[model samples]
Target: MFVMGHNQLPPHLKKFRRLVYISPVITILSLSLLVWTYSSDMTFQFITRYYHATSDPQTPVQFTLPLHRGPGQMGPEEQKLSLMAVNGTKTVLVAAYQEHRTGQKEVRIIAVVLRSETVAYRCLLRCQEQLRISEGVSTTHSDHFGFAYGTADIMCPLPLGCETASHVTVISAASDSNDTQIQEFLEVKNQKVQSDSFPYNFVVCLSTMFDFTNVLQLVQSLEMLQLLGVNRVVIYKTSNSPETQRILDYYIYKGFVEVIPWSLSKFVNVSRGWLPEHGPGDLHYLGQIPALNDCLYRYMYQSRYVALQDMDELILPQSVNSWLELVPLLEMKYGEDKCYMFENNVFPNTVSLPPPTSQTLPPPSCCPGWENVSGVNILAHLYQEPIITETHYTNFKIIVNPRAVFSTSVHGLLSSLIDCSWVDRNIARMYHTRASRQTELTEDELIYDGRLLSYSTKLIPNVNAVFRESGLLPEGSIQ
Candidate 1:
């Protein structure tokens, strides 16, 4: 096998093979060296620039952090914000004695913070005089969605005629303070008893309503409100059925109801209950707390008194004919600035209606085909259930002077600058008509409360008229 082979190849051929291997290695090393040199030079330049920037006093240095981590963060655009003016002047007019005092008005600013450092507010009041005020922001509460409810108070002094000032420019404070432009303009109107007063004396502020399909009950409720002397009713609507919308439009045209478009579903996942433990809404009950607060401010100066209640509930006076009569009597007994609380009385909707006797009045119907509607028949539910002692039976609702109440909750006002009085249940009570919370309550447990019977005659015709006008019923449906 030992014969002349490639091992004994010519010297020229062997030299070519060695050169091929060595050439590639040399190329790789040269490229690597060039890259290292370039990187080193860039690093040196960056260090030198940074050093000079820090060392020189004239050179401006800028630092940045994540917006959420930063001191003053600009929050999401969808965050709800509002401001309202309260008449700071107090005038006491007694029959025999009179006292008058004039003071600077106060501005209440509310900001719903989703994600921002709304730490302070800069308010500019431009009227007879240009006044600027700065106030620190404070969070009253927060919901499961991490929406921080914040408020700020600003004192505003205006010249005599400037009482009708419409707007105040407001801006959130920033870390890089360079006099940020006004982000929002808050409405400011004199709520005092000037030459012209608000047309409506009482307004019912309903909490946030979501996916409301109760058309029949809604109409009935509206009719009851009219009978109760409610001049206006404001509902914060998140969503509703087509039927409900049509009914609302009818009331809106009649100037009896105002619907505030609530578009919270577009931004966050809305939950049905107060806590997300049950479901997936961030703010409690479709941002109900905020809506209630907003309603208070929205009608603060427009209505003399505001009743915070649900659509299923009605605060009825046992002796008086209407709230118009009840409010005056209440004020005389409890004073003007006091918040009147009414005892809650539950009337279960599951209970069967009383048998139609000669004295019994026939319950009004919504329409022929609408007998099996989605909502409960409020008229059929007149059986008052015995109050459960362990539960918060004594839970109450409030009718407040919007100017005097500072903050509000579901049951009542959290704090009021004025006094609060609990009206006796025998005098006036809240008729809450809804599904029974308890699983069992016999006929013996239910008692007859005929307070609602008085409003039936008027309520039936009003509901029929509203349905007819809205085209929900025939044109001659009232007859």
Candidate 2:
């Protein structure tokens, strides 16, 4: 039965047997090849390019050492290749080994490395290109190049000109490479940005040139303001009109002022209606008036506060010590959010008689303290109230609460669209009668000027009569 079964068993069965025998051996051999590729000390010492047999023109052949074996000799039978990373840089290791009677002996290993030589070459090209650009020799797109090797630093100092070609390009190229082992480098960047700290608070900008002789006196008047503290006091000129330009130049030369020329003639037009032949018949041209409408517009629209005044009207000391000392005291009495007016009492443009042989009843000193002193109210006397005569040259002292004030006119307005009870504080006073000997006026003339509609000189007989009538003083100085 066994002998007859050989041919009858059939061709298909024989083929199946052959297949089973070959498949396992093929698999095992394939595995062995892989193992050898990984573990054997088979070095690909250098890379060289070779074209297929049918190339027309031969291309340049570049050779690079891909691996190096340490000095050792061994038989090929037991060599095993392995993979390794040196200094975090990936490399392939090919090991050599020998078979001893005991087992196997490792001889040496060769490391196959792919370095950044290409990068270095490209870097050289970039440097050359940069030189070309700097020299205006040629415009080329090949200005960027990158090369990296063996765990190089990210902040690599390029050899001068290489990075000058295009640092961003080089950085980008380095970023694109898969070799994460390379170090990244940064270039010196030049950019400036301003911080947001300045220009927050309100400002009172005084753009005038100070007259040297009278500047201290004028500043003293400004310094006497018991209201908000002065922000910036800029003096650009000194003296009256004839010497005004020269004084301005002097301040500019001394670096104490910024001169801005404004024509007094231009303002004459607005003043034609608002001002008399002299300045304001009631007050010195303070609060910018109508002349500096542009400055007023900017201040009203752009700035937080607007304080326009000239140099004479000063807030005199009441019971308080200095201007700085008076602000809080006044604020306490009249709520911190309020504006005030200090009525000026002095008459301007009066000349002294020659050599006062009899001693001109030492002109009535402009005084602040009087009887009946209260917050926001004081029965103070004035030589000439701007309210009456056409010569209303009396300056108005004002303290504007930034939050409550809007655009100013002949009078001030409130930002809040409602009317509130207005309180006056007499604790803050203004003395407006400091004048040169060149300017003086009799008490009778001051109190009872003929031009006044209500209180006229013709209506009153003398100083004694007026003082007695007003019940402010006794009849001692009156003749």
Candidate 3:
């Protein structure tokens, strides 16, 4: 009832009208600001919880989310991830990322595996920070094989007694609302048994054997390893002949050998030599470094010592017959934690013992099909290439305490938790049998060292039995 005209308003009335109009606008803005601040703080708190829950300060951090985002939307920090089945029940998720400049930045690794019916089980993998040269004594002087590699273990959540799982999707959490699918669900089978369950004293690790044609030599080498007291031989096989496969099967059945399918060809072109620059593969020495590291870890808790060597090489003890005796002697001279390196002594096949003059030679077709094998005949090759005093011997192999070795190369350990020294060739040395440097070397060039003669009595019969058992040789074939 007391409404005033627009032009004839009292001062008090005008002031009150202005106050009423301004108060509502100010109140609305203040309320809006308060709500926004509260929401922002809540969001920040949520993100912080996620970051701390899954990250480590000393190692790389992992982030996990429930949903996946497009690859285009991923931040620069997010790495390209992949999953490889190390064995049947265990799959190793591998990721390569930019090395943190500050060393303080966290790397978050969130892995999720899908069970049947789209049910997902989340896993937090702690990255085993790679061995850095600055951190400890690194024998690996070259960076030819350097890569920022990180691994996470995915224990398959399949039901009891199930060795494989199908249609598994692995997801990683990210900063964006969308989760990243690192790997699509594919068929995953358990290939490796628990390493802790392996009952072996001295395990021999042969890395990345490609295009294995030397069947006879392989069998002889295995037999010699057994003779030398090697309880188990693990070979990362790429491919081999049918004959070799049969031999491997025999050993596997006998529980003396383990063949890890080297599927590196599926990932990248594998080089045959350590110098990738001179070879075709991406990794040095047919990815030998990784395979050696894997073997070391696989046998760390299982075997007392693991010998890293080629299929054609044997670390023969000069005085002792079995490695069981040689190891204790070596450990006595060198501390137990030390990695023992053996000097390489190459013996070429061309300088073999003159065809047994005393005994009549059997017909060419009389022996098993494997008699015409591609590899060096260890029995025939008893003469070694004489050592040149001036030459710097670079080629050597190692027998290391699995727990002490952190990383390894074809020749020796790259990094060890303890000291490493060259084992005196007088006590033990590596006998490498291969094609002779020259077609014919004189008696002066060849040093007659018949170390293998001692094992021939047993090696010949054992190899013959395997050939017969595998149907490669007849029961009454050459005895």
Candidate 4:
């Protein structure tokens, strides 16, 4: 019987022992070498810089993620997002993000392209080894608001074993010519989106602000929204009066508003009206549909629900006090798929003050402190157009679950798993306090609902505080 001893082993055994002894030393030396390499200038530029997509891992990388393969210098500039125009095509890329909800591993690009333009899109996925080019499935949204330019979704499926994408860009392909044109790479969002990260119960999406100077109404409406359970309001602003910007800034400072610069005019001439024939522009309402879609994706994982509304409008709950209260009741009845369509009951801004209500009318608005303000006073107009008692109405707004929606319109959802169920006016309705589109209706035709008046007590004080803090109102003017 032959046995092996530690010191008296065979030559191969001795060699194996020496190797085992040096293994820990080799491992330690390798680790130390790595640490030294990283800690010193010996580190490769590609290795350290490309480790994280962003400096602050919690926040997303803005407009540009550091890569240099695209043709353009950069695209449109909103605060932290990009609006890139594809070369030799009418296609404009608003934002690109990894969408996991659709059961396809793809980069969903929200864009505004011509309804009939046969622009073939390719998704340039920033992969680990190579820039993957995948043919994108383009879907031009149905609700284009009768405009030439419509909101489209370019779904580019990710390559095999690609768990996450670094960044994404869209390229225009020519059928006649074999050359594909690539634009700038946009920060692919929603991959790092922490679901329910914030406590915003309802987020409001005001499509665009074009030449807006309505200060008084903006304040009242913003305050009213806050009171009605809106935690955050995302405003896509093109240009606004300084006074209006100040109000927007105040909300932004308060962390209640996100102002995304709407620079669609830089790329395409945006139409002032819904139809292209109504003006000499290309897209409708300053690329509002794209903005709405971007807003949807932006907050899809951030909030429970999103309300698409105008600055002058508020979707007030009739039975419930706040939207936080209202949405749960709706979801309970509709099972999370119903887009809570509220009847658009316009309260004419033409009326100086509504007929006196039972509650003491404090100058029909925020008391006497708002006379110098430049916008509409929502509290002043309590009477609105009579609710259309039918099952549906043409003019209506919606409060929707962002996850359930794919594409959005100014008034409703274009593509949503969410079915439109007109919320009973008794449950909730929209107070669209704009210049009367119902000018044909007589003064007597308008109904004095006084529903908005119920919130005037708290709204007035809250508004007064905002005005006083914003220096919009006189310090001692409590009259």
The top-ranked prediction according to lDDT is 4
lDDT of 4 by residue, 305-360 (tens): 78888888888888879987888888887777357888877888987554654645
Tens-place lDDT per residue, model 1, 1-479, is 12234477579867875768777456657866665666655765666578767775533222121213221222222123332222121110000100012344444444333334323444445554554444433445433334332222233343345544445544444333444342345555444542227777889989877888988888888888888889999887766776676666666645688877666555445568655576665446676766777677666767888899999888999898788888888888889846998888888887866634654655444345446446777877777877667644455788988877666877776666776788877778899888776658787778777778778777766665555556665454345
Instruction: Identify the superior model by TM-score, candidate 2 or candidate 4.
Output: 4
Q: How many residue pairs clash in all the candidates, one count each?
A: 2, 32, 25, 3
Q: How far in Å is the alpha carbon of 426 misplaced in model 1? A: 1.8
lDDT of 4 at 348: 86
Model 3 lDDT tens row, 1-479: 12233557678967876878877456656866665666655766666678668866433222222223332232222222243432222223332111122123222111211111122224222223211111100122233453222122233232333323223433322222232223333322222333354567899999677888888888889989988999999887777766566567667655688877665556545567666456564446655665666667667667878898989899999899999999888989997746998988878866655433443442122235446555656877777887766422667888887766545666776656677778888899999898765455676667777777777778777776666655555545545
- What are the models' TM-scores? 0.68, 0.32, 0.61, 0.78
lDDT of 3: 0.59
List, residue by residue over 1-479, the lDDT tens digit for candidate 2: 01223346468866775668777456657866665564222222111112324333333212121212232221122111122332333322221111111122111112222343222211111233342111111111111111111111112223433433222112123333443234231121111111223231223334333223442233223323212344332332212332223233333332333333223222122122224444332212321222122233223323333444444444444555444565566567665535655554443323222212344333333223212211111112224423345423334545444334322333333233223222242464444443522233454444422111122122223222322323333334323
lDDT of the candidates, in the order given: 0.62, 0.31, 0.59, 0.75
Off by over 4 Å in 1: 1-106, 114-135, 139-172, 175-179, 182-184, 189-197, 265-269, 355-373, 392-395, 476-479
Best model per TM-score: 4
